[model samples]
Target: MATTEGDQKLDKSTPEGAWKKLLSAQEYHILREKGTEPAGSGQYNKFYEQGTYVCAGCGTPLYESETKFNSGCGWPAYYDNLPGAVERHEDRAYGMIRTEITCANCGGHLGHVFKGEGFPTPTNERHCVNSVSVKFKPKE
Candidate 1:
Protein backbone atom coordinates (compact mmCIF):
# COMPACT_ATOMS: atom_id res chain seq x y z
CA MET A 1 0.00 0.00 0.00
CA ALA A 2 1.32 3.43 -0.88
CA THR A 3 1.49 6.07 1.84
CA THR A 4 1.90 9.83 1.77
CA GLU A 5 4.60 11.91 3.32
CA GLY A 6 2.66 11.83 6.55
CA ASP A 7 2.36 8.08 6.22
CA GLN A 8 -1.41 8.22 5.79
CA LYS A 9 -2.76 5.68 3.36
CA LEU A 10 -4.40 6.94 0.20
CA ASP A 11 -7.48 5.61 -1.58
CA LYS A 12 -7.96 6.76 -5.16
CA SER A 13 -11.51 5.54 -5.39
CA THR A 14 -14.67 7.43 -4.64
CA PRO A 15 -14.04 9.62 -1.58
CA GLU A 16 -17.47 9.38 0.01
CA GLY A 17 -17.17 5.68 0.74
CA ALA A 18 -13.47 5.08 0.34
CA TRP A 19 -12.60 7.53 3.10
CA LYS A 20 -14.71 5.69 5.63
CA LYS A 21 -12.76 2.56 4.92
CA LEU A 22 -9.37 4.22 4.57
CA LEU A 23 -9.39 6.32 7.71
CA SER A 24 -9.64 5.18 11.28
CA ALA A 25 -12.81 5.75 13.30
CA GLN A 26 -11.36 8.76 15.08
CA GLU A 27 -10.01 10.22 11.88
CA TYR A 28 -13.34 9.73 10.13
CA HIS A 29 -15.22 11.25 13.02
CA ILE A 30 -13.25 14.43 12.96
CA LEU A 31 -12.42 14.57 9.28
CA ARG A 32 -15.79 13.59 7.88
CA GLU A 33 -18.19 14.46 10.69
CA LYS A 34 -16.65 17.78 11.77
CA GLY A 35 -15.85 16.50 15.25
CA THR A 36 -13.30 18.14 17.48
CA GLU A 37 -10.95 16.38 19.83
CA PRO A 38 -10.51 17.35 23.46
CA ALA A 39 -8.16 20.27 24.03
CA GLY A 40 -4.55 19.66 25.06
CA SER A 41 -4.79 15.99 24.24
CA GLY A 42 -3.58 15.96 20.62
CA GLN A 43 -0.08 14.61 20.06
CA TYR A 44 0.99 17.59 18.00
CA ASN A 45 -0.22 20.09 20.56
CA LYS A 46 3.15 20.11 22.31
CA PHE A 47 5.28 18.60 19.62
CA TYR A 48 7.70 21.16 18.10
CA GLU A 49 9.80 19.34 15.61
CA GLN A 50 10.56 20.66 12.16
CA GLY A 51 8.04 19.16 9.80
CA THR A 52 5.05 19.66 7.61
CA TYR A 53 1.48 19.00 8.76
CA VAL A 54 -0.62 17.11 6.23
CA CYS A 55 -4.26 16.23 6.09
CA ALA A 56 -4.87 12.79 7.57
CA GLY A 57 -7.67 11.98 5.16
CA CYS A 58 -5.90 12.78 1.89
CA GLY A 59 -2.36 13.58 2.94
CA THR A 60 -2.35 16.99 1.34
CA PRO A 61 0.31 19.31 2.72
CA LEU A 62 -1.57 21.86 4.78
CA TYR A 63 0.71 23.59 7.25
CA GLU A 64 4.38 24.23 7.63
CA SER A 65 6.32 23.89 10.86
CA GLU A 66 7.65 27.43 10.96
CA THR A 67 4.15 28.81 11.01
CA LYS A 68 3.24 26.78 14.09
CA PHE A 69 3.41 28.49 17.45
CA ASN A 70 2.66 27.87 21.11
CA SER A 71 -0.69 29.57 21.50
CA GLY A 72 -1.57 27.73 24.72
CA CYS A 73 -5.08 27.15 23.42
CA GLY A 74 -4.31 23.44 22.98
CA TRP A 75 -4.73 21.34 19.82
CA PRO A 76 -1.84 22.26 17.54
CA ALA A 77 -2.09 25.91 16.58
CA TYR A 78 -0.62 27.42 13.46
CA TYR A 79 -0.40 31.02 12.39
CA ASP A 80 -0.50 30.24 8.69
CA ASN A 81 -1.04 27.44 6.21
CA LEU A 82 0.63 26.39 3.02
CA PRO A 83 -0.53 28.35 0.01
CA GLY A 84 -3.73 27.02 -1.52
CA ALA A 85 -3.74 24.16 0.92
CA VAL A 86 -6.65 24.92 3.25
CA GLU A 87 -10.15 26.23 2.76
CA ARG A 88 -12.30 28.23 5.14
CA HIS A 89 -16.04 27.95 5.55
CA GLU A 90 -18.54 29.63 7.82
CA ASP A 91 -19.33 27.26 10.64
CA ARG A 92 -22.38 28.15 12.73
CA ALA A 93 -22.67 25.02 14.76
CA TYR A 94 -22.91 25.09 18.58
CA GLY A 95 -24.54 28.51 18.52
CA MET A 96 -21.33 30.25 17.59
CA ILE A 97 -20.15 31.70 14.33
CA ARG A 98 -16.70 30.40 13.50
CA THR A 99 -14.58 29.70 10.46
CA GLU A 100 -13.97 26.03 9.93
CA ILE A 101 -10.80 25.01 8.15
CA THR A 102 -10.68 22.00 5.94
CA CYS A 103 -8.37 20.27 3.54
CA ALA A 104 -8.94 21.83 0.14
CA ASN A 105 -7.94 18.64 -1.59
CA CYS A 106 -10.29 16.23 0.16
CA GLY A 107 -12.74 18.47 2.01
CA GLY A 108 -11.73 16.87 5.29
CA HIS A 109 -12.37 18.80 8.45
CA LEU A 110 -9.17 19.89 10.12
CA GLY A 111 -10.42 22.40 12.68
CA HIS A 112 -11.36 26.07 13.19
CA VAL A 113 -9.53 29.34 12.69
CA PHE A 114 -9.84 32.08 15.25
CA LYS A 115 -9.02 35.60 14.26
CA GLY A 116 -8.31 38.92 16.07
CA GLU A 117 -6.87 37.12 19.09
CA GLY A 118 -3.81 39.39 19.05
CA PHE A 119 -1.28 36.67 18.45
CA PRO A 120 2.32 37.74 17.72
CA THR A 121 2.43 35.92 14.42
CA PRO A 122 2.23 37.75 11.10
CA THR A 123 -1.39 36.77 10.91
CA ASN A 124 -3.35 37.28 14.09
CA GLU A 125 -5.11 34.01 13.43
CA ARG A 126 -4.92 30.73 15.23
CA HIS A 127 -5.61 27.57 13.29
CA CYS A 128 -6.69 25.12 15.98
CA VAL A 129 -6.43 21.72 14.33
CA ASN A 130 -7.02 18.24 15.66
CA SER A 131 -4.14 15.80 15.65
CA VAL A 132 -6.38 13.08 14.34
CA SER A 133 -7.06 15.27 11.35
CA VAL A 134 -3.41 15.77 10.50
CA LYS A 135 -0.15 13.88 10.40
CA PHE A 136 3.43 15.14 10.76
CA LYS A 137 6.17 14.66 8.19
CA PRO A 138 9.57 15.52 9.57
CA LYS A 139 11.86 17.42 7.27
CA GLU A 140 14.27 15.28 5.37
Candidate 2:
Protein backbone atom coordinates (compact mmCIF):
# COMPACT_ATOMS: atom_id res chain seq x y z
CA MET A 1 0.00 0.00 0.00
CA ALA A 2 1.14 3.53 -0.69
CA THR A 3 1.85 5.22 2.63
CA THR A 4 2.33 8.89 3.34
CA GLU A 5 2.59 11.03 6.40
CA GLY A 6 -0.03 13.63 7.30
CA ASP A 7 -3.18 13.89 5.19
CA GLN A 8 -3.06 11.80 2.04
CA LYS A 9 -4.80 13.41 -0.87
CA LEU A 10 -6.85 10.98 -2.88
CA ASP A 11 -5.63 10.80 -6.43
CA LYS A 12 -8.69 8.81 -7.42
CA SER A 13 -6.76 6.28 -9.51
CA THR A 14 -4.39 4.10 -7.47
CA PRO A 15 -5.34 1.32 -5.03
CA GLU A 16 -5.29 3.97 -2.35
CA GLY A 17 -8.10 5.48 -4.34
CA ALA A 18 -10.06 2.40 -3.44
CA TRP A 19 -9.04 2.76 0.20
CA LYS A 20 -10.23 6.31 0.11
CA LYS A 21 -13.46 4.97 -1.27
CA LEU A 22 -13.77 2.37 1.53
CA LEU A 23 -12.75 4.27 4.65
CA SER A 24 -14.72 7.03 6.31
CA ALA A 25 -13.43 10.58 6.57
CA GLN A 26 -12.51 9.97 10.21
CA GLU A 27 -10.65 6.76 9.48
CA TYR A 28 -8.72 8.56 6.83
CA HIS A 29 -8.09 11.38 9.25
CA ILE A 30 -6.70 9.26 12.10
CA LEU A 31 -4.80 6.75 9.97
CA ARG A 32 -3.20 9.32 7.75
CA GLU A 33 -2.92 12.31 10.04
CA LYS A 34 -1.84 10.45 13.20
CA GLY A 35 -5.03 11.53 14.93
CA THR A 36 -6.06 9.70 18.09
CA GLU A 37 -9.47 8.14 18.51
CA PRO A 38 -11.29 8.63 21.78
CA ALA A 39 -9.49 6.57 24.48
CA GLY A 40 -12.25 4.25 25.66
CA SER A 41 -13.60 3.48 22.20
CA GLY A 42 -10.68 1.69 20.52
CA GLN A 43 -11.25 -1.85 19.27
CA TYR A 44 -7.86 -3.17 20.45
CA ASN A 45 -8.55 -2.33 24.05
CA LYS A 46 -10.17 -5.71 24.59
CA PHE A 47 -8.16 -7.85 22.17
CA TYR A 48 -6.88 -10.68 24.39
CA GLU A 49 -5.96 -13.50 22.07
CA GLN A 50 -2.40 -14.63 21.48
CA GLY A 51 -1.17 -12.75 18.42
CA THR A 52 1.14 -10.22 16.96
CA TYR A 53 0.11 -6.62 16.39
CA VAL A 54 1.17 -4.86 13.24
CA CYS A 55 0.83 -1.38 11.97
CA ALA A 56 -2.50 -1.00 10.21
CA GLY A 57 -1.22 1.67 7.88
CA CYS A 58 1.92 -0.15 6.70
CA GLY A 59 1.77 -3.75 7.87
CA THR A 60 4.96 -3.42 9.88
CA PRO A 61 5.33 -5.87 12.76
CA LEU A 62 5.28 -3.75 15.88
CA TYR A 63 4.54 -5.61 19.10
CA GLU A 64 4.52 -9.24 20.10
CA SER A 65 1.88 -11.00 22.19
CA GLU A 66 4.29 -11.68 25.03
CA THR A 67 4.95 -8.01 25.48
CA LYS A 68 1.32 -7.02 25.77
CA PHE A 69 -0.08 -6.39 29.23
CA ASN A 70 -3.31 -5.18 30.77
CA SER A 71 -2.62 -1.60 31.80
CA GLY A 72 -6.25 -0.85 32.66
CA CYS A 73 -5.76 2.35 30.75
CA GLY A 74 -8.61 1.73 28.28
CA TRP A 75 -6.15 1.06 25.45
CA PRO A 76 -3.86 -1.68 24.22
CA ALA A 77 -0.65 -1.55 26.21
CA TYR A 78 2.81 -2.98 25.70
CA TYR A 79 5.92 -3.07 27.82
CA ASP A 80 8.26 -2.61 24.88
CA ASN A 81 8.35 -2.30 21.12
CA LEU A 82 9.92 -4.51 18.52
CA PRO A 83 13.51 -3.43 17.99
CA GLY A 84 13.91 -0.68 15.42
CA ALA A 85 10.26 -0.94 14.54
CA VAL A 86 9.12 2.42 15.84
CA GLU A 87 10.50 5.96 15.90
CA ARG A 88 9.87 8.60 18.52
CA HIS A 89 9.51 12.36 18.23
CA GLU A 90 8.74 15.28 20.45
CA ASP A 91 5.13 16.29 20.03
CA ARG A 92 3.88 19.65 21.21
CA ALA A 93 0.56 19.35 19.51
CA TYR A 94 -2.71 20.26 21.27
CA GLY A 95 -0.79 22.22 23.86
CA MET A 96 0.34 19.10 25.71
CA ILE A 97 3.77 17.70 26.49
CA ARG A 98 4.18 14.25 25.00
CA THR A 99 6.22 12.07 22.73
CA GLU A 100 4.78 10.77 19.48
CA ILE A 101 5.47 7.26 18.29
CA THR A 102 5.40 6.35 14.62
CA CYS A 103 6.14 3.28 12.58
CA ALA A 104 9.73 3.39 11.42
CA ASN A 105 8.88 1.85 8.08
CA CYS A 106 5.88 3.97 7.08
CA GLY A 107 5.80 6.89 9.48
CA GLY A 108 2.30 6.02 10.59
CA HIS A 109 1.47 7.05 14.12
CA LEU A 110 1.36 4.15 16.58
CA GLY A 111 1.06 5.77 20.03
CA HIS A 112 2.97 7.18 22.96
CA VAL A 113 5.42 5.85 25.56
CA PHE A 114 5.68 6.81 29.19
CA LYS A 115 7.97 5.79 32.01
CA GLY A 116 7.36 4.54 35.56
CA GLU A 117 4.69 1.95 34.98
CA GLY A 118 6.63 -0.53 37.21
CA PHE A 119 5.51 -3.52 35.19
CA PRO A 120 7.43 -6.72 35.87
CA THR A 121 8.90 -6.57 32.39
CA PRO A 122 12.52 -5.48 31.99
CA THR A 123 11.41 -2.16 30.67
CA ASN A 124 9.31 -0.29 33.16
CA GLU A 125 7.75 1.49 30.23
CA ARG A 126 4.21 1.66 29.01
CA HIS A 127 3.48 1.90 25.35
CA CYS A 128 -0.08 3.16 25.32
CA VAL A 129 -1.21 2.36 21.84
CA ASN A 130 -4.26 3.19 19.80
CA SER A 131 -6.29 0.24 18.57
CA VAL A 132 -6.99 1.76 15.20
CA SER A 133 -3.25 1.97 14.59
CA VAL A 134 -2.79 -1.79 14.64
CA LYS A 135 -4.15 -5.05 13.24
CA PHE A 136 -3.95 -8.26 15.25
CA LYS A 137 -2.64 -11.39 13.55
CA PRO A 138 -3.36 -14.56 15.48
CA LYS A 139 -0.58 -17.01 16.20
CA GLU A 140 -0.38 -20.29 14.34
RMSD of each: 3.5, 5.2
Model 1 stretches astray by more than 4 angstroms:
1-13
Query: Number of the top candidate by TM-score?
Result: 1
How much is 18 displaced in model 1, in angstroms?
Answer: 0.9
For candidate 2, lDDT tens digit of each residue in 22-69?
A: 456666567567788887798888778898998776667899988998
* Shift in Å, residue 10, candidate 1: 6.2
- lDDT of candidate 1 at residue 48, scale 0 to 100: 93
Task: Note the residue pairs that clash in candidate 1.
Answer: none
In order of appearance, the predictions have TM-scores of 0.90, 0.80
Q: Total backbone clashes of model 2?
A: 0
lDDT of 1 by residue, 6-120 (tens): 5655533335676777778998899999999999989999999998998888778999999999999889999999998899999999999999998887788999999999999
lDDT value for candidate 1? 0.88
